[model samples]
Target: LNHPKLSLCPSLIMTIAFAVRWRDPELVGPARKTPRETKRLSDIEDQAGLRWHVPFVLFYRGRGGDAGADAGDPAAAVRRALGEALVPYYPLAGRLREVEGRKLVVDCTGEGVFVEADADVRLAEVEAAGLTPPFPCMDQLLFDVEGSGGVLNCPLLLVQVTRLRCGGFVFALRLNHTMCDAVGIVQFMSAVGELARGLPAPTVAPAWSRETLDARSPPRPSFPHHEYDPVPPTPFPPPGDMVMRTFTFSPADVAAIKKGLPVQRGGKKATTFEALAALIWRARTAALEIPAGEDARLVVAAGVRGVRDLGLPAGYYGNACACTCRRCPPPGPCGASR
Candidate 1:
């Protein structure tokens, strides 16, 4: 990951200072009683590398009127919606336990963390500072409760809804990576939103047939799995000097980039993602001054939900993606081209 220096003016920097008063943490269970069952996670899901929490945040502008008046108590609404959503996605409310051979299983304990908070800033102020990646005071915004950060025998999902003084709220959550990937989490959150909006049930029912993705007995290796191979360590700048930035490209910018690329023999133009990824990879390689003799690689995660053979149901929210690596050798013509 490249960390370019952030150049912000003095006025913009002042917006970073804000205090969030967090309420006592509470455990929310399914609105209705869910079955008490233990289910083993797929081999891919419980891999040693996937035992961690992934944090995400979303900002919403305040509705007209005083805080909590027009919104009608967002914290309570979120809590209620999450409880109802947990009825089908109960595994998320369960705690992860390690059984024999270090395998992971959901204990179906029916408990998830929820925190209500209030920030002393307006939504407009936050947006003016730039509503992008590397958000300011992320720790306070998320608020990792004590004893809630463990990988095993801990809450699988932790949510904190911070209401801004202007009535807008920040929705943040930390989800266990072992349980699901980005797609899975998004599906679950969407369901919660639907229920909050008075939907009878989730548009797509949640499914938990993880055994379908389990490895076959006496695993057969069909192709090379180089992604899991150990990678040589590379030097990095000090953490203090590293800064993450988000870049936005308009549709015109994307069209311009695609126009510069060589046309395909079949007349199929490169996609926006393909063009941008290629452009960034080449620019990053050049900016880092990597040696011409060294190999540069880009790893992209491709979704496998569309694969009919996998038999992943409509709402199978497990890790159903594969990482493909593309290696570029030296700064050749392909890398130099627009």
Candidate 2:
């Protein structure tokens, strides 16, 4: 990542003053209750985790000096809240281990790491510059990505809190995508925020029954599931150049797109997400300039959080998402509406 061309990105302008590793204080200690044996991942949980890392960031506005006594000290509060939050979300404190089957399971070690840093830039300047993607702001603030071995050897959940010059801060996280999904991480953060706000405990305690998402014992199937089928290993091609970009859609714009979608006769109306996804799929296909006889695929992530029959509890904070691929002919107006 130190390539000269990459450094030309605007976010590199923000400098780091000091970065220190903060571990859980002895007083808070590790969670007393943890799984005894290695928690195996389901087959549906693809091995792509071996290479993927999920990066997320949270922005908090600072309370000026006159705000309150506790308001002046933010880092201490975050440490305290994190220590308390680790009690229920203990798996995050663990390290990845390889078992006999060559599969990885968490060691439940109770030793997550946090990095606290001081940034030279102010929060206002960052917001003004636009925190768009290729999310350089987050990359600049997080200190864990360097030197730490990839997902396999890195901490299960690593956090970086950058104190902006204007007193506000940016909380950045890099989690092993193999351990949890975006929903699960957000739930974990919500619990930490609740504790920071003086709540005695999280509203929903975490459940770690990876077996809950397993396929039926006999592997009975009512329909074909080609998406979840395993494929033989293939030679990996060398890396290619790719450009990362992000597009923003306001609530009003999203609503307008949904309204424009043709509704089914006497059926349910399309959701805002479905409408926007279809629009993007069509637009992207049109831009690809592929042959009409060829096929185009779109992989969409579907969360099983609230599906009644899955029997997943409110706090089942693990990988509970499935990636479904839709194949269509690269012809006129992609009408795939998933």
Candidate 3:
């Protein structure tokens, strides 16, 4: 973002020299495509897409540095860990790319502003199953997180780990601004903890360069900021709509809600979020439970991103977000694993 040394690019501006050759297809005619080239487009177009700007994704992996986990020529551990970890990641190499390679994510995309985080956060996952390995990244994961959720452009990985003398690990992760917003970062770390323990990774492979307004090729023209804002104020289509609201709670109120048996009538270990959401759902259902003819629904927004690096595209300036429905049949009672 603000880094000077290793930051790749501050914005997506195509040099005049390069933009010159991009011809108006209607005026000059479509550029001739060889049979092989046409097939390549056909083959990958279904799966692969254009990302607008460059991005950087960093994943931190650490082993004890001493004669123990961090010790004893531990580079082997690094190699082994990366190998096994990325086993399901082969299709991702080219899948994640940049307009120009860089060490930091936002340097190239010219996509987002920087936000600072000083506190550590945590997230929990439930168990689920649908697809196994030997696959490309999922288009959507729990809460609709994507393997391609990094920015549409800047896709690189930054990883740092320190082996604690106490045999613990300290990791630092950095990424481009394109794929995820601030909250998505925390979800990613929690997902990583799960992955290290051999759990299923989140889904939500990002979609890129779908709109001309986002601009896949550059000389990146200046445009209205709201056009690229990921969450535009407009309402979602007929089937899905979103409302933003905030709740206030005092310490004692939260404590009472957690401890009161009435809150846990069914013997459930209700999480703060889950309990709160359930309360809202029940109250709302009771108030508006009677529909003239159909079932009611509750939806929750789920932030998404790749725990590992993804090659995205340039010209990407977006909010990088998706949602998952709570009512969707769960793999089990605990819900979905992200």
TM-score of each: 0.91, 0.79, 0.28
**Best candidate according to TM-score:** 1
CA lDDT of every candidate:
0.84, 0.67, 0.31
Give the TM-score (vs. native) of candidate 1.
0.91
lDDT of 1 by residue, 256-314 (tens): 99989998869999999999998998887776667776667777888988999988998
Q: Tens digit of lDDT per residue, candidate 3, span 65-182?
A: 4325523422233323333333322111222332333211222221111111111111110002111231111111101112323543322333333232333333434443333345
Worst 10 residues of 3 by lDDT: 18-27
Model 3 segments beyond 4 Å from truth?
A: 1-75, 95-154, 174-255, 258-271, 274-338
How large an RMSD does model 3 have?
19.1
lDDT order of candidates, best first? 1, 2, 3
For every model shown, the clashing-pair count is 0, 0, 49
Q: Residue 82, candidate 2: how far off, in angstroms?
A: 1.3
Query: Considering only N, C-alpha and C atoms within 3 Å, which residue pairs clash in candidate 1?
Result: none
The Cα RMSD of model 1 versus the native structure comes to 5.4
Residue-level lDDT of model 2, residues 282-320, one tens digit each, is 887676565666666667888888888888887888888
